[model samples]
Target: MGLRFLVVEGNTRGARQAHKQAYGLTLSESYAEVLQEIEGGAVCDIAFPADEGANLPDAAGLESYDGIVLTGSHLNIYDRTPDIVRQIDLMRAVYASRTPSFGSCWGLQVAAVAADGDVRQNPLGREVGFARKLTPTEAGRAHPLLEGRPAAYDAPAIHLDMVTALPGDCTVLAGNAVSPVQAAEIRQDGGVFWGVQYHPEFSLGELAAILERRTDILVREGFCRTPEDALAYTADLAALHRDPTRFDLAWRHGIDAEVLEPQRRTREIRNFVEHRVKTEKSARGRA
Candidate 1:
């Protein structure tokens, strides 16, 4: 049987609509596209736990999938609002179901909170665009999730909240100077989750859209001297996305093959499907 996967969108209805408007695709849609690209013949279903009245899969339903992916969001998990609470509940159910799971950005924060960890606004300020110099820990170097990752690398990212306290059953993987818990593996209640604070699923165009949306914030945060500068930077990112062969644009932004090459940029997501999802599916006779 072909692998079946579930994509849990962490964004609310409004945020998702905004994303669609700005990026031309909802976060979940982008995740589904990337998953299909990574594992052709794999099928994906999307769930919106953050939207009120949205139907979510129960434990049995969750267990039926070969793997689950949680997408990033604009909501703050620390707020404990109804929408946020619903996502937390769904994550707990995901854990109980023991399905192999992966998350990015807000997805990672949600998983952390559901597993008894904590998240807070980063004191060092928002780490936008690319997360730089992500060095793997000893555990990460040996971890399968980062099997093909270099000693130090960069990935597409944009977030202000970070995991402040880790769960008891989690192991820190890779971290950078900005955030100490960039990547981790959490094992709880027979379930395994591999997550990263960066967006391995994001395309350069998507990053440009996000930067465009947050132009004012980028300026206020001192990332750019003015909105025009921010827009100019995003234009360059979009241009590079249109044509990756633009070495001048790549050099201007100090970006390398790690962020420019699709395979290298999404290595973590591919690793999860191979090392966790496919491995477990085979062991369970579902392969």
Candidate 2:
């Protein structure tokens, strides 16, 4: 039988213009779509708009699922909004039930908070587009999530809030100059959670769409010389992924290394599925 998984999307109910243009999907829907690509063989289901009117599964309901995925959000972890609070409550339940969970971006912050960690608005400002070369920690070097990850490489990212402190039991996996806690593994209430501050589930096409949606802001934040320049920057990322011989093209857009390696970008997501979730199925069969 296939593994059962649940996707708890952090976005609110309303759809965004950018998402509509990119895939005609609601924010939560798009997240589910990408997650489907990573946990490919699993039977996946989604719980949407976790903040409002969300019907979070009870403990028994959670146990039925082999894995749970938490998607990124615009909500700030420190905001204490009712919706954010609900997500926290859900995270707590995940631990109490010992459910295996994984997360990205806002998803990571929520896990950290629920696990007794701390979060704050990044004083370094928003890390838009991509986070580069998040070097693995000594622990990450041997971590299952970094099973085939390079020592360091870039991944799609866009976030403002970050984890400032982690639960005592949490092991930091990777970090870089931009974000101190780029990824972490947590153990709490008998549950295991793996999370990343970047979006391994995002495709470069999605990243470019996100950049286009935030074009004006990218210019205002001085991330680009102009709105047109922001568009060009997105195009560069696409180019890197498109051509095999364009290894040198990355430097022009601040992307280092020989070329854009798709595997490098999706290192964590594949590892999580192949190692963590699938491993559970094998263990269950043995039992």
Candidate 3:
């Protein structure tokens, strides 16, 4: 059987913009890569609540998955909308269950807020495009997932708000000058939980589309004066994408190392199981 995973996507925006506006990786390519890895011989299912307005899958229904993953979104967790509230509860349930959960971008904020942390817009504003360095703390240096990683790592980032304070039990995993909390993990015995502020899921093409789609917002926010400037910025990213090795050198954790393939693969398996768990029981009832 395939691994079961419960993927909690924030809303339709997360689904629609994940590739073009967020990670910069094509949805089909990213989803296919993940499905191929997690499915292996078993089934893998990626679930979303449709929109912020849609109801979440029941907690009982989510309990069967091996792990869970949270996707980034345009919505803010601080909002009182029913959909945002539902997502917060979903994240809370995942944490309370001690389920292995991974979060990216907005996913990181969701995890932080659900765990009693704080998030706010950085004084530096939007950090769209790229980061050439992510300096891990001493604690991060000792971490299993981060050990052997470099003192500085480069990754693509896009966000206005940054996680400012972490919960009591969480350990920071990565950071940079603009955002102090780049990634983190909860302290638990034999449990898995991690969150990254950047989008490791994005490829260059996907990132450019996001910049293009949000051109007006960027201009209004003073991120760029004109479309041409935005295009130039995105173009630089495309060059790095074409030759990842140049930028890979700066990312501390050896995200490009062959050794980490095992860890990445393990994450894929866990995610697969978690996604499947959320849907397995429903499928069985029909059987």
Q: Identify the leading candidate in terms of lDDT.
A: 1
Reference-based TM-score of each model: 0.98, 0.90, 0.74
Give the lDDT ranking, best first. Answer: 1, 2, 3
lDDT of 3 by residue, 74-149 (tens): 7766664777766767777777666567777888888887777877878888887655477878887776545445
lDDT of 2 by residue, 139-232 (tens): 9999998887777777788998899988978999999999889999999999889999998877666677677778888999899998788888
Choose 1 or 3, whichever is better by TM-score. Answer: 1
| lDDT of candidate 2 at residue 87, scale 0 to 100 | 91
Candidate 1 accuracy as lDDT: 0.95
What is candidate 1's lDDT per residue for 205-280, written digit by digit as tens? 9999989999999999999999999999999999999999999999999899998999999999999999999999
Q: After superposition, how far is residue 118 of candidate 1 from its true place, in Å?
A: 0.3
lDDT against the true structure, per candidate, is 0.95, 0.80, 0.63
- Model 1 alpha-carbon drift over 4 Å, by segment: none
TM-score between model 1 and native: 0.98
User: Ten-residue segment with the worst summed lDDT in candidate 3?
Assistant: 257-266
